[model samples]
Target: MTASRARLAGSTALVTGGSDGVGLEIVRMLADAGADVIMPVRNRAKGEAAIERIRETVRDARIVLHDLDLARLDSVDALTAGLREEAAIDICVLNAGVVLLGDRRRHLTADGFELHFQTNFLGHAALIRGILPLLERSRARVVVQTSIAAARARIDWNDLNGARRYSPYRAYAASKLALSLFGLELARRSGRITVNLSHPGVVPGTAIAAPVRALLPQDLVNWAVHRVGNAPATAAQTAFDAATSEADAPVMFAPSGPFGLWGAPVPRAPFRRFLDADAAARVWREVDRLLS
Candidate 1:
């Protein structure tokens, strides 16, 4: 169903990591569709700059900027509280993420948790739970942006926090896997709410590679990605399609293009082990205990 039947127009939508890149593109599309776009970004100044770019494309776009550091639980708490009081959000896109450079041996958050897990997985999960009541009131939909890296690493429940060993790439992959699990679990538990996951292909041109380029020439990575990967706009299209498309099941898995590698956003491959109810429940139970 389109926005009219879904009642998306004039309703509020929230996009985490909406400062730039694919997330910003998603914000623009949602704004054009008549949803008030709420951008929760890590750097307040950069986010405001991004809002300027959106204004160029979307006139009269309702965009709200709020500071949110996914690496810190406290920041998520503040964002959820403020948004809950202000908006009856109709959709939420969990799109913010980070890829640590190889030079960094170990990454840690302000609260001393593993950076990737806390920021990309745990922090977002907590925020989702915090905002569940708002979603319930509005009957909203949520789309979690996962990655192809999720297939490379399975979430080892015992090492979720990465206290045992620290590898940035593995840590990132594990976090995405955990998010995929949470998406499936959330759909099952809520039963009434719409929950889905999408992978935005290997968008080599995205801001994700900018930090690595600061260390080494980014052109090499950019070249390889452009040859076979996706554009940020392509990735954004997948996210937008996955979020707006109605499906029979609550949990929808989509990839950018074909064979789960890259293309437009369409239902691609099933997330490995995601259909395991036992594992999903285990993850949910463990996460619940930690958050509690």
Candidate 2:
């Protein structure tokens, strides 16, 4: 609601993980703006329920739900193919991700890449590639949801899978870093399509917080989360801006409050590494190889 809710009227949008959290907020806002939203949910029932909730407010909302498992590349392909059969897409939001704080052990996807790496980074890479033609047809804006944690992360180029060293936070940070690279590189490569990255900042209500909360006392956890985390709608502003704004702004959008934690959306420089075109290109090449 911070931005113009009617900005995307008469458009088509595809959002990953639209079932909950900031993604759900984005879906709702887009639907309110009169966009035909295509949501790829892992759980069809949960997706239908979210659509029902949105319908309560936007009675004429247009939402199409498709089954997608980002952990599996085949699922990504299925979604891309389905999208191609429809009209050109105006937006694609890669927002689904996970933080394996509940399990410190390194887990791999069916394709053998680290779980977070594959789900957060590689899956998105493959998806954008498969849907490149549709994006080209519409000159779509691609918004990748990254994290502020990515600013502190270093892509362990030598041990991309965390085989040598791994921690819950480290793995998640690396995946975000990779995603940032992909967004920047994609923008550089394709002039017809607009690509941007956004960080929702600290949205404590998000499911990624579930694993960490399990380790803390209920009362203390609730108090701490309330103090540090912005509401999902507030955090979602940066993402919404990146997706719908027409301003010729920086490609990275983040929260505008203290330490980029909470406020309205604003464009900011990403990490220093993200500025390096060479590094971005390198990551893109690596991602392309993995997806191949």
Candidate 3:
């Protein structure tokens, strides 16, 4: 494996969902690269376990864990409130997300929006806004985790909640698409802080997809995902590279192999729909309204 090219000697990073999967890999990479990393996890036990696992490889890795459940707005608020007084984050990776393909039936978060939408898009939006002051203070750049699905996804603005028509794939794709738009819009609005988006391609072994995989045919799941996706560690490189690179705008990064399924990190734009400035503004307004 090629070593990561980015160096972060005096930087501090905040990574969401760093307990497992690609997020975990990013944490390990960031810590290995000499950055002080802060991770917000859903529970203490999992967080501690993750820390232990990382330390096994990085003996002196600087990692701090806090409680954060992105599915709940209150949790997102609580975490940011603490950060405001603690430290200025130099790099923020919004990587926590859920993909529920177990049942196509729609589900709602505590805030009453579609579960995937809230956790993947709305919550991250709130966290970013809440930490905007610190980010600006540090000239921090935001790294948003999107997906290849977003390249083909569309936002049903009229039905943001997926209440009218729902499908797991559609809901997940739409949430990621919304995230891509948020990153693009943030870059357009801010001159001090850079905002970039990355698609990790297909990571078949992610714990995020485990729930859905449980209900599906095991062989079929393995076949379909393994056929096109890389392991979480491999998939994470694109986001890691983008997060630590010198890109100063809203560039989207993805792998550079057959169908963007695997390889080194490369700049790849999403569909024009994701770059719609008006749509991005509309989504930002809607997110603020929802949070309010």
Query: What's the TM-score of every candidate structure?
Result: 0.89, 0.93, 0.92
State the TM-score for model 3: 0.92
lDDT of 2: 0.84
Which of 1 and 2 is the better model by lDDT? 2
Encode model 2's per-residue lDDT on 1-292: one tens digit a residue: 2235776778999989889888888888888887899999999999999989888888888999998999998898888888779887998899999887778899988877899998888888888999898898898899999887788888888998889998878899889888988888888888788888888887776767777678889997888677776788777777778888675434788878888887677888776867878888999889867776
How many collisions per candidate?
3, 0, 0
* Per-candidate local distance difference test: 0.78, 0.84, 0.84
Stretches off by above 4 angstroms in model 2 are 1-4, 215-217
Which residue pairs clash in candidate 1?
256-263, 257-262, 257-263
Encode model 3's per-residue lDDT on 1-292: one tens digit a residue: 1146237867899999898888988998888888889999998899899989989987778999888988899998999989998667899999999888767789898878899998999999999998898998898878999887787898998998887889988999899889889878887888778887877876767754677567789898978676757777777787788787787667778888888877677988766778789989998898788878
Tens digit of per-residue lDDT, candidate 1, span 129-244: 99998887776788889887777676766777677876778888888878878878888888567877768877766655556556656677656676666777777877787677
Better of 2 and 3 by TM-score: 2
In terms of lDDT, the poorest run of 10 residues in model 3 is 1-10
- Residue 49, candidate 3: Cα error in Å is 0.5
Find the 10 residues in a row with the least total lDDT in model 1. Answer: 1-10
Clashing pairs in 2: none
